[model samples]
Every structure is written in structure tokens, then in C-alpha cells.
Target: MATILSIIPYHFYPPVGGGALRCYNILKEMARDHTVYVVTSQPEDTFTSDEDYTLPERVVIISISKMLLHISGSSACKKVFNAISYRVKKRTLKGPANSFFLASYSAIISLLKDVKFDVIYYESLESVGELSGPIRRFSISFTHIYDAHNVDSILWAQQAKALQNERLMNYANNALQLEKKLFKCIDTFFCCSYEDREKLIRLNELKISGIVVPNGVDISKKPYDDDAFKYSRKNIIFCGSLNYQPNIEGLLWFYTAVLPALKSAIPGLVLTVVGQNASYDHYKALMEDESVNFVGTVPDVNPYYYSASVAIVPLLSGSGTRLKILEAMSLGNPLVTTTVGAEGIRYEDGKHLLIADKPQAFVEQILTLLTDKQKFDTIRQNAQKLVMEIYDWQVIGKSISTQIPVLLKEKYGGR
Candidate 1:
């Protein structure tokens, strides 16, 4: 058995988003035969209750609070850092800023004074940047694993180009420079896809050890009836957190470009939106339209996925694999996503799901899903088959459990 430590920036129990979902599932699996410690965000921010979530036997939740910066450094310095976090949250809506996130090497190190962990899984940019200074101080040796949720530099550069902001470009440059330093401290990087792994290697111009661990759905969590799709309504479903900038950007783009034509053609067509809401003020017309219904933050998303005729992912820009795609596919909902939306996942267009980039093409794809019963059934079966064979969390988790120990043994000579 091994001792593993995971420090993610958000609350992961009963995970709401992709990152949180990945963290929760991975740690649960890791705790099977190992001692797994999680230091994640306070539940007051990401989630409120643990009524439904059952803890794994060997999994331990170490700490849950805001230690964003080096809280143990100095009183005045901590206040300054907290103030900067406040300003950033207030000024911009982009990025994950629900509250002061959970991240601090000093705080974590202090708690784990004498104990030595065999593996260190660092999950956010805040956590990654702090490891270089702290890991050197500890005499114990361990394999530091960096969980690359997305390529930070690329995502930041995309934001800069999209918004035409020089400040964002500077931030992107700083991110890349920080990664160059981070490369030295981290022994292995767990990327969501081989595509992301390739991009990271090309950017740093270094041959680094990395593994592809894709986002997955917990297939056996609840029983899903795939036959429900045959009797479901012709309505479309689009699910994602509105707090995220990319989801908002994608939805608004679709609403402005394709909704009118789709609504005109289907007459009674409705787009049901699910997930947490934070940014929808700019798109008032969407809320006012009778053809669109926004169902924000449901206790259960499986019913929504089961009831809809087809699920649509209209993302214009983002990185990493999307959990929504896997979730929809796992529950027998055929998908239509843009090329940007379909990144990272090894999805074959027209087989697992339909892909379209242009506005008219996207609309046509949705129309086809609604009209063509044979094509929809074929895609649905293929997608569900793909999920059962590859994207199910149980299967992926077992693979992760097997790989981590082997990597640690290979590096440290069977400690």
C-alpha cells in the first residue's frame, strides 16, 4: 500500500464540473488499497451538503479551507495576497473564482510535518506554482504528479486573442514561463488526452514523462435505461455551468446564430439548459424566448440527459476533455458538437457523434438528429459502446490504480 496526497482547488464531493468530477473519481479509486488524503476547497463554496456522498474506506479528507496563497508565510503578506484574490474575483468573471480557492504548500506541509507521502498529485495552477519551493525543503523523496486539466498557456493566449487584451497576453507569457520552472519539480504529468500531452511537450520543447487520463462518467453510479431515448421528446439539451466563460460564450453564439432557424423549423422546439448559473445577463433575449427553458442546477442531470432527443455542445474555445460529452453519450443521447467543443476526446465524427463548425452546418446536424431515426440510433449505440469500453470511470480508475504504483516503483526503485 502507498500513501498519496491530492490537493485540488475546488470541492469535489458530488462533483459539479469536469475538474471536480475527475478529482473525486480518481481519489476514490486510489483509496482502495492506499491511504489517500485530499485537501480541497471548503464546501460552503462548491457544494453545501454531503448527504448523498459516501466516503471510501481508506480515503481521508485532510483540510478544507481557503489557503490560496502562502497563508503561513506572514500576516501582512497573507492579507495582501487575499486582497489581490478579492480584486481578481470582482474584476473578471473568467476562470475558476467562486471563492478564495484551497491552495497552500506551507499549510499542507505544516500539517504533514513528519509523515512522508509516496505520491503527490497537484491539481491547479495555484498548487503547481507553489511546489517548486516547498518540495525542495522536504528530505523525503516522492514522485510529484502534475494533473494538467488544460494547457494553461494555450487557453490564456486564446483568451487574449479573443478579447484583444494585452494584459492577458502578458499573463499567458508568465504562465508559460512558470510551467518551464514547474517542469523541473514535477516527475510526471497526467494529461486528459494524448493531444494535450503533445501540445505540452511541443510548447516546452522537452520530452517529459506524461500519461493520458481522460475525463469519464461513473457508469454504474445509477441504472440508466438506454431504451428511454426511443420515447423521448424532440427537444434539445445543452448542459454546462454558466459560471464558466467558455460555456456562456458557446451558448450565446448558438442562441444568436442558430436558435431562430431551429425554432422556426421545429415550431415547438425548446432548448433546456441545465447547470449552475452565474453569467447570463448579457443574453436576456434567450431567457425571454418561450422556446428556451433554463433549468439551473438540478439535483439530478441524468433525467435531463435521458429525456432529450439530442445533446448539443456549442463551445467556440476551451481546452481539455468535456465531461458533458461523455455523460450525454453514456446515457444514450446522441451529440452534435463543434470542433472546438470536441477536442481531447477521441471521437469519430458521424460515428460517435456529429461535428460541425459553421453556424448553418451545426443547425443542420441538429436537424438531422431530430429527423433521422436510423442515424440517431446508430450514433447512440456507438457512443454508448464507446463509453462502456473506454470512458467509464470504473474502467479508467482501475487503469489509474495500476499505473501509479508501477510509475512510483520504477522511479524510486520500489520504496
Candidate 2:
């Protein structure tokens, strides 16, 4: 088995998100067959504690300092000073830039100074530039594989179009340029959706070969319990990492457009919004409606999934596949989602999930699902079957593993 060194900004076990969970799950599975070493950033609290990381025997955790040298919204003078410091001392850039540069720098230096690994698996393009300096040193040869979780450029561009704020739009435009430049430097790229892959091919005008390793569901967790499945309330659920702009916008849109229509059609139609780091302003605004319940950051989301009559994804802007959709499908919840929200998932318009882009269509679908038990049950069963056959982590993990040997052969020249 090849010695694999994986670098991610975050991992599983604590302070979780979809990206972190996906990274952890893939690395955990990879560790079972190979000698795996993971280099990641840790929470400041964990740095001082002697808590054992929940990882495989072959996995290694390298913790880095989370010190912020300069706050993100600093003045122009502060920005210039920090940029000089970062350039000269190789210190990290502030905010979102910090995790990418600092973690990669620390990991590359640590690997060069101490540990030896056959391959370097970078989870995203955030730190691809860091590898350039190390690659120039001829003695240490390691293959690089990049997992582009999403087509970040497309995501930024979409955000730029949606945002009214000029400063945010300009930032998003700059981010898109950086992402495009970064994609050209990687050896291999993995994306979550074919749409994203196609976008890259069109944008770069290159026949860049990559695989669509879509996000998956860990069926073992079994998100919905028996009691939740039997809940009588006609509930509609939207679950996601609320801090994400797309998710926040989706939830806000649902409340503003669809919720009133659904309430008017079916009296006492409950809408439960479940997620972490949900904005207090958003929560308070929704709470004023009386029908909306904002459940912030539950330990387990399965119960909420089960309790819902139908899961809704009203995403307006996002680049990749929705893991939440996969999770809801795995849990056997009948779903109503926008065409954009349901992108990349293999599902029929009315079979596995009800697809509706407009607010009126969304409300109509929800009303139909609420009233028609047979249709709801049929879609639920079909979604669950699809999850079992195709979208499960076990199946996805094997496909991801298959690529490793091919990558190894291309890099090392031997089986």
C-alpha cells in the first residue's frame, strides 16, 4: 500500500461541516488499506488539551497554531504590512487565506523535515501554490492529487452575480480569477459534479481529465428513527450549514416566497429550519411568522429528518451536488427541491424527488406531498433504494480507491 499524506483545512470529529466530513470519511476509509497521514488544522481548544483524536491506527494528526496575526477587515496599511510579512517570513495571509497557506506550509515543511510519504493528496485548491516551492527541490518526489470539492470559480461567479454589495461582488470576482489560475497547476482534479467539471473544461479550454466523486451518505448513521418517521405533523424541513451563503439565501427565499403560499393552502403547515451557526437575525425574522421554527445546531439531524413530512432544498446559488439531498434521500424523506438544488443527483422530476424552481411550483409540490400519502411513500422508497444502490459511501469510497492505483502507476511507473 502506498503511504498517503492528505492535507485538508479541517477534518472530522470536531468543528464539522460537509467538506470536513467528506474529507474525514474518505481518509478514514483510505486508511484501512494504506498507511495514511493526515495534516490538518485543529481548534484552538484542542491544541492545549490531551484529547485523543478519533482516527484509524495508521492515521497521524498534526496540529498547527490558529493564531491570527491580522484581522481580515484591517486597514490598507495593515494589509500591506501583513502582505510583506507573509511574503518575507512565509507567515499566513489573514482570514480565509490563513488555513490554506499556513496549513500547507506547515505540512510541507513538516514532511520535508521529518516524515516521508509517497503521495500528497490535497483536499482543495486553496493551497495549491504552496506545492510549487517544494516541487522545485528534486530529491523528494511525491505525486500530487487535488480534490476540488466544488468548482470554486463558478461558485464565486454565481455569488458575484447575486450579491448587491459592490465590495463583496468585487471580492468574489477576484476569487474566481484565483480559482481559475489554481486549477491549471494541479496534476489531477476531482469534482463533485459533471456540471462543475464541464464548466472547468469550457472555462480553461483544456481537456482536463477528472472524476465526479459525488458526496455520499453514511447509511449506518440512519438519520431518521421510527418515532420521527411516524410524526403526524405536516412538516417541511430545510437542513444545511446555515453559515453558507447559498443555504442562508435559500432559507430566506423559502420563508419569503414559498412559506406564505404553503401556509395559506394547508393550515398549520410547520416549517423547521435545522442547521449550525444560523444567523440570529434570520432566525428572529423567521420566528415572527409563527409557522417557522429555527432549530440551531443539533447534535444529530436524523430525528429532524424523520419528523419532517417532506425535506425541501430551495438553493438559489451553489456549484456542486447537495450532500443534504443525498442525506435526506438516504433517510427516506420525500423531497421537494429546486432544479439547481437537485443538480448532479440522478433523480426524476416526480419520481425520486419533486423538482420545482419557482415559488408557486414549490408550494404546489409541497401541498401535493402533504395530501397524497401514496405518492409520498413511492418517492421515499425510490429515493432510499437509489441511495442504497448508488449514493452510499461504501460504493463511492471504492470508486475513489480505484483511482489511487491508476494515480500511483502514472506517478511511480510501477504496479
Candidate 3:
């Protein structure tokens, strides 16, 4: 078995977002056959002494609390200032505000001592700088694997364009430069989509290509319940963290442009927005509307998935494969989504799910799916089957683990 060290930038257990879920699932999968060590960060206040998460006994989790420039559980004003200051200092410092994060690396390195890891799996490009220095100093020979949740540069640039924020724009530009400079250090790149892999290849002009490891759902953890499917289901579910800009942007667009038309077609239809940290302050009208119900954060999202007739993904801009789609599909719900929403996943329009970019098309697709039972059933079945065959965490985890030996062979001529 291989000894793997994974470095993540967030408190990964009890995954609260898509990125966290992906990291946790990947670690869980790797722990099945490998001695996996997780080095992650958390705010000092929220750091827990008790290990509450469900994981294999073989997996060792280590947290670096209150690391450099890392803040959590802070007030809104504090958060805003911290964000701005971090960005400003990042530019002034000519590098990431990762000094404290890098310092935590020493603790991790000291803990490992003489033990040599066969591979290093670093999550997100943001951690590359903090990890690179320590890994180089600690080990002479080890394969480096970069798991790209999204093309950071591209995603940042898109967000900057959307928000028109100068700091974000500068940050985006800086990320682009950093990615180019660090391209040579990565031995293997695990991207969530072909689009991202292609972008990396074109940007860096690298001879080696990335492996597409799409976002997946843990079906075993939350298995599909056939009884949850209702013949008279009038609920249209939209699941995503409300605090995320991309999700909020998509929700605003759907609420204004598409929801009215869809409501006109099916008067009884009620849209249920489910997920954590969804602020209804800007969406006061939606909150008051009887047809729209905002279920702000739930411990179990499976019930929402199980009860809905169709799930809508109205994403305008984001990168990487969406776990929302996989979750909805795995629960046997038909989906109507925008082109941006369906990116990276091997989804066929009108087959696995309906894709619509414009307001009229999006509304029409939802209406058609709700009216046509045969089409809805076929699409839902296709989606569930597709996920079962391809996007299951076990399948994805195995695919990732199997690559270690091959990458090892190429690097050292033996596993």
C-alpha cells in the first residue's frame, strides 16, 4: 500500500460544501488501501479536540489551527475587512499570505519525521505555494498530485468580471501568473472536467495532460429511496450554498427571468431552495412569495432530493463539475439546467438532463419535463444510471488510486 499525504486548506470533516465533500470522499476512498494522512486548517476558535467525523481507522487527520491569514467564525465586518486586507497584502507581499500556512508545514513535517510518503496530494492551486516549499525540503523522491477543484485562475477571472471588483480582478491576474510559474512542479493533475484540463494544457503548454476526475456523490451514504418519488410531486428543488456568489447569481437570474414563466405554466408548482447560508435579504420578494419556499440549510438534503419532481441548476458562471447535479441525479430526479450548470459532466441534452441557456428555453424545458412523464422518467433513469456507472465515489476513488502505481512506475520504474 502507498503512503499518501494530502494537504487541504479547509476544515474538511462534516463537509459543508461541494469542495469539502470532494476532498473528504477522495480521502475516504484512498484510506481503503493506503495509509492516508490529512493535513488541513481550521480557525482556532472552531478547532475541536474530539474527532467527530466518520472515517476509516487507518486515516489520520491533522489540523493546523488559526494558520496565517486564516480567519473563521468572525463577524461580518471582520470578515469583510479580513478579506480586503488579505487581498491588498497579497499584492504588496508579492506572494500569497501563506506564511503562517507555510509555518504549519513544519509541524506536519516534524510529525512525520523519518517516514517518507510515496505521494503528495494537494487540494486546490491555492495550497501549492504553502506545500511546495515543505515537500521539496522534506522528501527527495515522491510523486506530486494536484487535485484541481476548479481552474482557479479562470474561476477567479470570471468572478472578477461578474462582480467588477478591482481586488478580485488583481487576484485573478496574480493567480494566472502563479499557475503558469508552478505548472512544471506538478507531476499529475486531477481535474474535474476536460474543459479545465484543456485550459491548463493550453495555458502551460505542458507535455503531460491532466486526468479527469469528475465530482461524485456518495450513494452508499445516502442511498436512493424509491418510495420518496411522488406521482403528484409539485416541488422544484434547487440545492447549493446560498452564500456562494455563483449560486446566488444563478438564483437571482432564475427568480426574475425564468420562475414567472414556469409559474404561469404550472400554477401549483412551488420552488424550494435548499442549502446553507442562503440570505433572503436581497430576495425579500422571493421570500414573501407563496410559490417560493427557501429552506435555508438542512442536515439531510436527501429528503429534498427524494421529494422533488425536478431539480433546477441555473448557474451562470463557475468552473469544475457540480456535485449538486450528481446528487440530484443519483436521487432519481430529472434536471433542467443552464449550459454553465451542466459543464464537465458527460450529460447529453434531452437525454440525461435538459440544458437551456436562455430564459425562455429554460422555462420551456422545465415545463416540458413536468408535463411529460415519459420524458421525465427516461431522463431521470438515464441520469441515475450514468452516475451509478461513472460518478460513484467508489468508482472515482478506485480510478484515482489505480493511477498511483502507474505514475510511480513512470517516475521510479516500480511501484
In model 2, the Cα lDDT at residue 24 comes to 67
Per-residue lDDT value at 114 in model 2 = 74
The best candidate in terms of lDDT: 3
Residues 94-187, candidate 3: write the lDDT tens digits. Answer: 4433544543656566755866788888886767755665566666588888888888888888878888888988878888886775666667
Give the TM-scores of the predictions, in the order they appear: 0.87, 0.86, 0.89
lDDT of 2 at 36: 82
lDDT of 1: 0.77
User: Could you tell me the lDDT of residue 163 within candidate 1?
Assistant: 73
lDDT of 1 at 11: 66
Order the candidate numbers by TM-score, best to worst: 3, 1, 2
Better of 1 and 3 by TM-score: 3
Relative to the true structure, candidate 1 reaches a TM of 0.87
Clashing pairs in model 3, backbone N/Cα/C closer than 3 A: none
Off by over 4 Å in 2: 43-53, 66-107, 136-140, 182-184, 223-232
Best by TM-score: 3
lDDT of 2: 0.73
| Alpha-carbon runs more than 4 Å astray in model 1 | 43-51, 64-106, 164-170, 228-232
lDDT of 2 at 161: 68
